[model samples]
Target: MFWRRWCGLFLDQKRRKKSDATYKNYKHILGEFVDQLPASVRFIDQVNADVLDSHMRYLESEKAAPKTISNKMMVVSFMLKAAGVATPSKMMELPTVEEEIPEPYTREDLQALFKAMTPEERVRYTFFLDTACREKEVAHAQWADLIDGKYWVRKKTFKARGGKERQFSPKSHETRLIPLTRELMDMLNARRKSSKSQRIFPNEWGDPEGHFLRKFKAVAKEAGLNCGECETTISEGRFTKHPAEVSCLTRPVCEKHYLHRLRKTCATFWHEKHIPIRTIQSWLGHKSLETTQKYYVASAIPRIVPPPCSYSRRICSNSSTLVLLSTRSSLGAVRPEAESRVYGFQ
Candidate 1:
């Protein structure tokens, strides 16, 4: 069968079982693969070792990340296998994909990001940090999903008038419950009383908001937290007919600023609070505990400690004298205070 025909068959098999995002991703990968195929290679059987190698080379030439390349290649292998062709493993070696370390946002970074957001944006992002839910899960969350002080992540189906069906489900099709803090619960209750839509957060059209990452980057830029070094080519308004390469310095397109980092930060916070790996995995709705350990449990908290001398200069720059005061407090009650003085020259 032709490459496109085989790809269609494979996608049809996946369409019913996979989530919309997964189905779209698989379709995109297969479409790209078919597009990159040589004209001579029409049938699945014509896809030999050399063809796989050439495809890998094309992916590398496009400067795709190692993990992305591996994922695409895996999809290609699946397609070939579904078509009863020999898989790439028997003929060629796959590229090694390095394990990526998760980088969660620090308290300071979170503060800056929150400071840059509006009141409405803060509430939306606060839900992200408190729940550690994926973007889609958060977007699709409804008041009905919250039951007895816990938020349930589950599959939801929407039926169209023409008998067509659309479904929204958690990643891996795993449904789990996450407990919320009292403060968050109180806030949510207030919003619930005032909200007109069924969704906890909704756009002007009363649908789940989808363009969160773009707004997040804007907040990062407004907070002056953007790295301002990364650059990419993109097309803008009608005035700019041609795509222009731009830097993050001019545009709010920093790689470091994203909604997922908030999720990672929340997971890391849970880990730091002595939460068990299995529990964290369940809260994250991960099918495997290894994912929680590999990404969240092993993530490090960013820290910066200044030298002792620098601390004095930085704290008391104008004065030659420094007084260190310590206080003991319990339950908002002050107990005692101790004072020490140090003389220093600027």
Candidate 2:
């Protein structure tokens, strides 16, 4: 069969079990790839190493990001493999993209975002920042998941290895229990009193698959946490202004203050409170301790100042004053009794 025909068949097979969004993404990326191919190449077998290498060059010339190129390549690789074709051995030499470290949201940033949110937004946003659930996990949460002031995040939808779609409980098929703070509990109680849908945080249409990021960014833009401003322009006799793009802030705001950052922020908050790395790993639903330690945990050392000790002047020389250099422990705080004994002037 021709590569295009095979692609259409693969897409149809995927659409039967996968989501429209996933299907659309694969189709779009594959379509773009096909556009860059030579018109004479009709069969899947005709697409060789040289064609792929040329396509990579084309993608690079178009200024596609390294990550984007890698994703597109994954689609191509999958399609080729599915059609009983082997990838070129030399095609393994793709661009090495560095993983960017996730930056957590600051307490001040969360506070600002909270202040700008509506009551409904506040309840949902606070849940994300507190629970550290991924966007999809939070979207799938139901009132039934709330048990004894804790939420059990059971995975509802997942994309398995090889881009196969399935409905299951979380990424690791594990249910995570996240303790609810008093604030979160209050929000839940309030929501439960008025909510009609089974899902705790649902869209206006009461769909379980809610678009949380849209609301999150809306609140973020209003809070001035973002760096750009929306300027209205009349194009083709239509006036339009994207409020999300409109910003007056002079300083560059970190664009990483999205929903995922809230998850990182939750992890960071726990790390700051002296929570063990392993404990944090389970709470954040991380598969590896390395993942928890390397990405989620922040490197902030707490700065706790010890209280000044009052000493008798009679014990020391009359003209000489004792200088006690303020020191901190690994735990960041020194006990009041320990402080006096260590720095006593004699």
Q: Highest lDDT: give the candidate number.
A: 1
> Candidate 2, residues 30-79: lDDT per residue as tens digits?
89888888988888778787888888889999888898888888888887
Which regions of candidate 2 are displaced past 4 Å?
A: 87-90, 157-169, 229-254, 296-346
Off by over 4 Å in 1: 12-24, 86-92, 159-164, 238-241, 296-299, 302-346
Model 2 local distance difference test score: 0.66
Model 1: worst 10 consecutive residues (lDDT sum): 306-315
Models 1 onward score TM values of: 0.78, 0.74
lDDT of 1 at 167: 79
The superposed Cα distance between candidate 1 and the true structure at residue 92, in angstroms, equals 5.1
